[model samples]
Target: MMAHSPGDTAFLPSLPQLLIDDAVRAALREDLGRAGDITTNATIAEDAKATAILSSREMGTVCGTGFARAAFALIDPALKFEALVRDGEKVSPGEKLARVTGNARAILSAERVALNYMMHLSGIATYTARFVDLVNETKARVCDTRKTIPGMRAFAKYAVKCGGGANHRFGLDDAILIKDNHIAVAGGVTNAIEAARAYAGHLVKIEIEVDGLAQFEEALAAKADVILLDNMGPELLEKAVGINAGRAILEASGGIGFDTIKAVAQTGVDYISTSKITMAAPTLDIGLDIEIA
Candidate 1:
């Protein structure tokens, strides 16, 4: 069973088991390739059994224990995988998060892929946690954009939620977000919103992205459900907030970082979206140590 953290229950939904299993299977297949752990197959006896501990080398939030277990199971169905902690739980250095016991060859072969998922997902969670902490006192909520890795979108966004950030659109089809190019093609903000309304169902909300106050006013006049304030500095954001006067949900996007997020949050926007948390977060340091008996 997957562990759930109380802090993440609101933002993180239950992920589909089939999807996670398929992803892990693909990753294991990729690693196994043609030869398939030749070193392990040659060095270890086929019947040899061993135990391994997956431990964090640094402090961070955990987000991919399920994926790690799936990887081991895919490698060898009989492998015993125990998750010591659930996804979204925080951990410190020297903390053992999971234990795997199985055929020595299976354990060795699955180690790298399992560690890769856990470390990368945990890193995203940790990075997002910093932003969430910085803006905890503010009315604004932190969220992630569609700028996620191609196949890893589900896992990456899951980690973001684990770190206390919300998710924007799951995909392009999920909502109507009128970006700069959409505006340019549609002739203006109002036109884009109108066209989107006609193109989408009534349930689809119109979120128009504006580069400055001029477009902000147009989007506001058009009554957008959500307005994305793109690349606006603190001054402009403050002015935009004032002009908005609670007219719509304002989202601060574009190039936001740790140093600027607090100031952005202070501007009183409804949501702050950043791609750095998912795109560039450094992998958390985690390792697997094996013991053969």
Candidate 2:
């Protein structure tokens, strides 16, 4: 079994501190508002100190502990934040993930924002882990799509990595992915591949999406670096693999779910990209329980 300790980012590269701080501050702002945790301020003594336990209510792969810590730091610089489990570690129900000791009001104020990051990101990691585990024996690897929350792409993709999945292009500018629309606009699959290859330079690898064998052949003939096999059933995908013969990197995508992913993986595609890992992951049940000491 692998262990993830506090600040252990070995599963994936940590997101920039600036980005994490900005996001944490924004969440704190929204949570605090103009009144600033009115309930805590009204009921809790300003000078009171307390301890809060970050615990999991269900089994999941832990993530975003650092982000949660940042939330507390933004709320009160004096708060003592400690992570018991590292990111990417599988946790069981009732597990104590971390602890924060500091100003009671600050702890109460940071509770929601902290738990929100842990729960949401852990959900993505857990869900992606399921998909990754299913296809572990296959030649294909699970990957995440670009369908992520507007401001949380980096965080969501990081969770995917924690779950043992690979990441596709982080953004449109990161790589050239010519999809159906790009093909239609360019008049054909071959044209789209050709145009992408011409525009993208050696630094970029052009991947084109093809819905069927004809377009697959066209893209192959155009010497695309990678090919996306979109929405094709196992039979078609196997045929595509047979025809492809390793000429380019084959990615199976579109409507992939737990029920169909195994079959899709057996087709010998190099990658399986899905939106569910990021866009549809269910947030894990986690909470912060504060106890004054």
Candidate 3:
């Protein structure tokens, strides 16, 4: 089953078996290509029985264990998958998170696909947790942006939540954000804000992106619900906040790094969004060592 979103009450007791099936199927087709597992086919009996443990090679948060198990379970329903650690729990190098024992071919076939998603998603969660930790004592909440892998945004956002970060719009439909290009196209901030408010549904909030204090004041004058103060240093951000005076939700964007995030948080923005969290987060170091037992 997919891990529940943080604070989510809804439970996904089991994923549609098809998600696991399709992901594994595509992975196997890619890895096998035209040759199949040549070494396994050549050297090992098709029905060879084996037992293996899933152990971590680095200290980090555990994620996607269920999905990893789902990968193997898809290959062999009776494959023993015992998860010794829960998703989102901290783990150490050499710690055993799960054990799988079943047909050797099934275990070998599912290995790579299982490791790919687990490592990738866990990396996202780990890095997000880092940013979350950076601002734990402050008022700002770490958030992830649209800079996500194309087909895996939902899973990526799920990982962000697992790491104590919140998700922005899953896509364009959920929010209306007017940027520099839109302001230029519409002739000015006034035109852009007016057009957005007019064209948007009542429930669709309007946020305007401004690059400097002048634009911020214009945006506040235009009555934007959220003002994305782009690349503003803490001093300017403070000035912008004083200008805004609680009339809108203040969001800080651009120039955000671990060194600068806490100071930006101190600038009194409600949230800080960054593509760096997703684009720059390295894949967590994780591996599966399979041995016959």
Candidate 4:
């Protein structure tokens, strides 16, 4: 499958089942440990069955329904997990996101893991949506950084898309991003871009981070595919935009918040990347309530 870019907002694709299965399996193993859901084993009868509903307790976007379904299916194939709403859809309080029916013990065993993925991902989606909404009127798109939980980058990025945000390079291998450290090691911005250009294949696009107008001018001269305007407030960003005159894709990043995003977007940057979407997002509150039937 082709990687989703910051511009692809209309169609949100599901992650590969193999990837989902691998992640869900590891989580289940971590949670189950050596003995496995002992509390459920000790309390619930083996043959007992029950129904449960996964409901949102607060307003937010929904994500990770597939992961939640995988959690239940992996625990017990007999469990029937049904998604009431797809990922990227908004939900209000008391909305049911999914329903699970089957062995009561399996439902109980998988509940926490399911909720973990959904709640965490939904949080990122909700937070990203806020940023996206803030910049809706502008040409700038909100994008996510790699500041995600170590093993959860793919899942987190997917959630960002669900919330209407764009994605930056998934990893170092996908694109050439010359940061300050890379430039320092290479001796200068021009040298760094030259080195990356020589080494990277034609399919790769080169992007460089610049802190000042001088460096931005150098990057523009180097014909970098994308230029990251780091930590430039509204005034500086506007100046950078004016200087560019549509030479390359301009991205404004660094310390951008809800209050200032609109101003940043208004400066006419193509994208705004932030770590807050993945790092500082609050988990959306969701719960599984066992049906009394």
Number of the top-ranking candidate, with TM-score as the measure: 4
**What C-alpha RMSD separates each model from the true structure?**
2.4, 2.9, 3.1, 2.6
TM-score of each: 0.94, 0.95, 0.89, 0.96
Query: Model 4 over residues 63-131: C-alpha lDDT tens digits?
Result: 899999999999999899999999988899999999999999999999999999999999999999889
Positional deviation of residue 168's Cα in model 3 after best superposition, in angstroms: 1.0
- Candidate 2, poorest ten consecutive residues by summed lDDT: 1-10
How does model 2 score by TM-score? 0.95
Error of 3 at 228 (Å): 1.0
Query: For each candidate, what is the lDDT?
Result: 0.89, 0.89, 0.79, 0.92
| Model 3 worst lDDT window (10 residues) | 1-10
lDDT of 2: 0.89
Clashing pairs in 3: none
Model 1: per-residue lDDT, tens digit, 257-282? 99999999999999999999999899
Error of 4 at 71 (Å): 0.4
| Better candidate number, 2 or 3, judged by TM-score | 2
For 117-190, candidate 3 gives per-residue lDDT tens digits of: 88887788778777877877777778888888877777777677766677777789999989999999999998
State which candidate has the highest lDDT.
4
> How high is the lDDT of residue 292 in model 1?
45
lDDT of 3 at 142: 80
Sequence-dependent TM-score of model 1: 0.94
